[model samples]
Target: MALKDEKVTLAHGGGGKAMRDLIEEVFTSVFRPDGMEDQARLQAAALADPGARLAFTTDGFVVDPLEFPGGDIGTLAVCGTVNDLAVGGARPLWLSAGFIIEEGLDLALLRRVVASMAAEAEKAGVRIVTGDTKVVGRGMADKLFITTSGIGVIPPGRDLQAANIRPGDVAIVNGVLGDHGAAIMAARGEMALSAEIASDCQGLGHLMEAVLAVAPGLRAARDATRGGVAAVLNEMAAAAGVAIEIDEAALPLRAEVRGLCEILGLDPLYLANEGTLVLFVPEHEVAAALAAMRATEAGQGAVAIGRVVPGEAGRVSMRSAFGGLRIVDMLVGEQLPRIC
Candidate 1:
């Protein structure tokens, strides 16, 4: 193809000379700045020891209407990766981005998303050192998809996991719940009443840093993403072979989100969240943990919502607003399947 008449072809996904040509010509050349490629390898080589334990995680992004009211796919992808590292008690250092672009996606739009991702990386003090790209036939794939892989190093003398949970532990949330899911529904014109609900898609590392600084012995922390706070709690209960009792009255629910959930017949407890976290702390240290969380942007709405109990493991029960009790279960199929 001539310089002025280039077209994407199936060869782009082959990982061969033609594939490299497409990636070099269409992707890196368009989105990356100088010295951007292969930074992961370069940084990994410089680690204190190449054999050190590394925290690795990967996720795929395919939210519809990529650009939403509060955020787009690029920002969510970056925040998701960083939040995972943060909650795992690791210092995020590097990332690898993989893109699958539909054949006819606007080059300018792709550029904008890539730039937003770069900005997020800079904010989190992480670098996108390596990546791959493939373009499919226009009708064969969605507009664009992003898969981000992150690597971080855990600090010494601090350990956290589901198995650490036990009876007499308190459960806390970083902030009010269900905002992100509500925002996405509103942005998509699925909600009847329109308020300026925004997706809380932000990196929670800074907030986690604040809490860990004060309580290095923090038991367990998880971002309330797809399955929300309710789903995460159930997972923890099962993992630790314990049961959890949550006070519905104590669960923070913004009036707007709550109202929408009721109208739509949706349970806010199992809704989605992008920037919120559910953490388990020792009963005695709940106050300090809540205080530290409230001090950070990601956790200003933090609150103690429940406690751990021993009984039937893997189950979560909630006190109703009417003083009744009910079960909170995992999302059956998909609440927002590709909203990640």
Candidate 2:
């Protein structure tokens, strides 16, 4: 029962004294210096925010290893949920975290994750308003898993959706593709290879604001997470009933990432990305959108890679570097699971 020998146990989730002690000594100690409460309360005026619409999103993180090159699971939780709201033209404000910790897990590891989450929230200017914790048997779950839900304010007349995509709309990526996936894969150490790669995990709320400020007519925006840009484009093409054509040579892929994908027989376009985003902007606004994206740290490498066209609805094609056309289909199965 002492801190020195402490490890997560079912009693820590029993809603009893053990639960209180665990939460107080660990989560609250990092997440809230003030105190812990059953629920987080905010002023009505704070939520109103000039009558802006609310964007709500929730995501789960079960990434293996829990930590990777550029970030850890804690940072991923905050960035992933915040990016969800950002892509919808929202300014993220608050988040709720839930942890499913496995018995026998090291308390120190849990503290490290909690600390990372707290730090990332501060950087993104969001609050960890409320949270819950549960402990399962050692074999019932992985070492730890986190679920984060967030809410944000969307300005008036800033609606964004894939259905708004039209012919001539351009597809743009914020940065190099597949860094997150490649980093995670390399971290796993299963391939017995080495490459200098890091997960491209970071908040995009500021980048979205900059682009929206200049190109309010942006049709759609999405973080290239689980399925990467290929999935995003396929979904958007289907939603907008248009075909998407991308130039293979235009994709900004890192040499390390490309090499990793090549050795593993994976397509960088299909690999996951944590910080990258895909934006669809009208032809007239493409230049301004790129300019706005390049102005922000998160979007400095932004480039227009493709365009929408009239064809079979829901089709995504790429012009191969070898001068042939190929379909970029939705991944039949996960290429790298638990990369996020």
Candidate 3:
């Protein structure tokens, strides 16, 4: 209620009382950072460990519809940054958000987005300590775009990387694939298709922690975001200098997602996912890893989808349900743009 305008204007971005009111009422009020300084002065006990390492990552989020079925751009921004750090075996701690908001955007919508960001950060155990906002002319930008940078700590002696994967490693996914993409596509309503799919948008820091607790030898994990599971699998194979073979029957997918892809003539493997991730763990520890993952809310659908093997390096193949093999290559181009 502090902001008097129903829609944002260029004055809101100017360094004046309007801008200050917007920032204080819309953003900082919800984030509640320790101070209003231009930069966040961060300190954490985990960083005090002599052998611990710092992990930093930044990502930008833009989707056709700012709000979606399961999540809006705000939820996507936080979860995406948190998952980026979590997949690298980091304990996410802090984040910075930057907003490029268009004039005429509803003030209520901006408030909702800020609230969503704060809630997700709390759930992911991180703080939004600093942020910047700019309002542009109506046609100069979309309704809103968010860029998030995250900071995390890697415990001493924990070095998870794709190159650490070995031939005997097994691949596991956190949950069903293609739901996010399918949900977005259906939400667009361009094809007259209807289905009850929601974006699996969620933070994976807790799930990663749970798995690492039980399977210390876990190799690496990648969130199937822009390019989906096939993209992650190919990257893992190429980085580890090994071949990956996934069983078609083992891929966890919903029947609605399958039907959507079939109707659109799209391959499900190329579909994007927000909460799904593929990880590699030693064959000996697959059971433990899957159990640990399933115990977490973000990983209940965890399953072994594939295994590493000795073959032509950087090659990935899929075994069909009928017992036939086909190469799964890097996606030549995007199947859906602006998916993340």
lDDT of each: 0.81, 0.89, 0.93
Clash pairs of candidate 2?
none
Off by over 4 Å in 2: 33-35, 44-46, 49-51
Off by over 4 Å in 3: none
Worst 10 residues of 2 by lDDT: 42-51
Give Cα distance to truth, residue 19, candidate 3, Å: 0.5
Task: Write one digit per residue (lDDT tens) for candidate 1, span 217-296.
Answer: 68989998998888899888888999899999998888989998888788888788889999988888888888988887
The stretch of ten residues in a row with the least summed lDDT in candidate 3 is 331-340
| TM-score-best of 2 and 3 | 3
Cand. 2 TM to true fold = 0.95
Please write out the lDDT profile of model 3 over residues 1-340, one tens digit for every residue: 6689999999999989999999999999999999999999999999999999999999999887888899989999999999999999999999999999999999999999899999999999999999999899978998999999999999998898899999989999999999889889988888898788999999999999999999999999999998899999999899999999999999999999999998889999989999999999998899999999999999999999999987899999999999999999989978887878
TM-score of each: 0.89, 0.95, 0.99
Candidate with maximal TM-score: 3
**Best candidate per lDDT, number?**
3
For model 2, the local distance difference test gives: 0.89
Q: How does residue 73 of candidate 1 score in lDDT?
A: 91
The per-prediction CA RMSD against the true structure, in angstroms, equals: 3.3, 1.8, 0.7
